[model samples]
Target: MKLVKSLVAVAITVSMFSCGNQVKEVKTLNTEIDSVSYAIGLNMATQFKANLKEVNDDAFIQGYISGKDSTNLLVAQKDIQTIINTYLRKQQTAKMEEQRAKAAKEAEAKFGDNKKAGEDFLVENKTKEGVITTDSGLQYIILKEGTGDQPASPSTRVKVHYHGTNLEGEVFDSSVDRGTPAEFVLNEVIKGWTEGLQLMKEGAKYKFFIPQEMAYGAQQRGDKIKPFSTLVFEVELLEVLD
Candidate 1:
């Protein structure tokens, strides 16, 4: 009986690895098979492999272990492997789904508040071209216009000089601070930028009243901006590439 079980396990291992097109599938199948096999083998190894040597009659071993009588044991081994494979596959799939749900919940929680703040700013300012609104609700007027080609769509690289400030008149980031024009793809910039630049021709300067939503929403503007901040940018459309 012990020799019969050992032979059955070995035969199943051989058959599993034999199919050509199923080679990769079989390797994954084998990993699951090996896990169960390891548990079973550890529990039964002494009886299945070592005790066979103590059997006194060779004919009794050959009749019961080698020929037609071994068929039932082989069937049983295949059934056990099938059961273990089904169990582990279901366990892993459930774990993955649980992780996905957790990630989605966290994102909604983090971004929801900021999005609401942006919507509030939009309601108060009512978006119009060339208007400037500051964090504490002060506004500025555009003083000059430049002569340049205007961007018609989201597609275009632009060059500009800009100064930003709060309602209390504190300067934030400025291209003037670096004494050079800021260059970037218009479509790749913030919503206020993409919208405002489209309204100006290359060499045209416009003062933009960027509400928090159109700028950075309720998010902090790097080290320079605070939550629920509106911004003023005096932008010059120096050039448009493509």
Candidate 2:
């Protein structure tokens, strides 16, 4: 929602600047509109990325040229209007629904492989030395003990550095790689983090093995993190920030 709002504001601001107070005359209206159109293109180009599979730059520019001069159109103008009708906001709900269904099916197929791999990994991981399995199915191994006696609690906000990976050992996210410690309330993160952090004290380092249900569950995150992934993380509790 914030992304959409920011992009819309940028596009509007660019258009407004191109048609300033002193440039409202009818004689130069076409010229002013051309500037506004290019401004809008610049605004959208800054935000949206295109793919060769979907549409390339050449195809996009061809569409723009066709729209600008409808007379020399390769196809019937009536057919072009029909395509525009398809793009109307009111007509997109069903199309989006269909796309969502297709994506969900693809995710399901991927998760099928994920589930089998996760089950095998956890089964073998539990047999390793110092690996502790809790009643909630969270697993962890303490790498270093804390100097302080204070353990983390649900309401406690703490500064910590962490590195996360999947069962295949692919690094997905890391505060350590970014060279920064993150602060978060114990209860506000993934269920695995909330449970695992409470078992640690200040300055302690631990590695957590989190099942997907306790992490992202069925939701597909960005380009890296997928649906129903079993995650591993090495987390160090720096200090309770609040």
Candidate 3:
């Protein structure tokens, strides 16, 4: 009877120990599952916040809010804003480039017209003297007579004083402003000066009505002159040193 009682006590103790081990294992597994689920949930929330920030800061969204009703049409508003912003930027750039090209073309045209006009004036004026006539029906008078021999053909070095005006009697360039005589070579100057100086002897002065071609051509000498303008000048021959 004593041996049997001892064996029964040993069996009960082994069973209790086995049951406690099973309970501990189950608790550990449950804790691991709960931790994984929490991590997944946290990650999902973080991803959502990032997406929200991106959508809010996008330019398309801002544009939609400016023009459209966003309260009821969120998707449509966003789309419209994107399209409108893109279109406007492209249009603005294209228009600016077009304006630049147009300005360049106008400048070129003015220059060509002035050059042609000057050539025509030289052709019409047949007489060569201190005085000259322009095709534009303007006339120039000589003021002083030069004594030195004229320079070689196509040569440029010469010194003179000049006063310019328009047919309506508008004064333009005047050497008297700087209180000094203007100097330039014939070849280096406008067509009008080149042709006109050839006719002058040393100590001779001539007045000229220079068309745009003979003056600055298409370019304006200053604010007072315009493109394709006509000019008048009283030139006094001081020296022909070339």
**Top-lDDT structure, candidate number:** 2
Write model 1 residue lDDT over 1-242, tens digit each, in one string. 44446645543333323234132233333476666655554545565334432333444333334333344343354475465456456655776678866754564466566445545655565555555655544333556665757776888888888888754468888898889998899878878788777767776767666766567654566766665566777887788877
Query: In order, what lDDT does every prediction score?
Result: 0.61, 0.73, 0.59
How close is every model to the real structure, measured as TM-score?
A: 0.47, 0.55, 0.45
The 10 consecutive residues of candidate 2 with the worst lDDT sum are 17-26
Q: Rank the candidates by lDDT, best first.
A: 2, 1, 3
Q: Residue 216, candidate 1: how far off, in angstroms?
A: 1.3
Point out where model 1 deviates above 4 Å. Answer: 1-142
The residue-by-residue lDDT of candidate 2 on 1-242, one tens digit each, is 32243333443333332222222223333576666656665566654432111336555445445544454566675575454444444335766778877876687786878767777888899999999999999999999989764544688888899999887788999999999999989889999999998888888999999988799876777866788788999999998777
- The TM-score of predicted model 3 comes to 0.45
Q: Model 3: runs farther than 4 Å from truth?
A: 1-131, 134-139
Which order, best to worst by TM-score?
2, 1, 3
lDDT of 1: 0.61
Candidate number that wins on TM-score, 2 or 3: 2
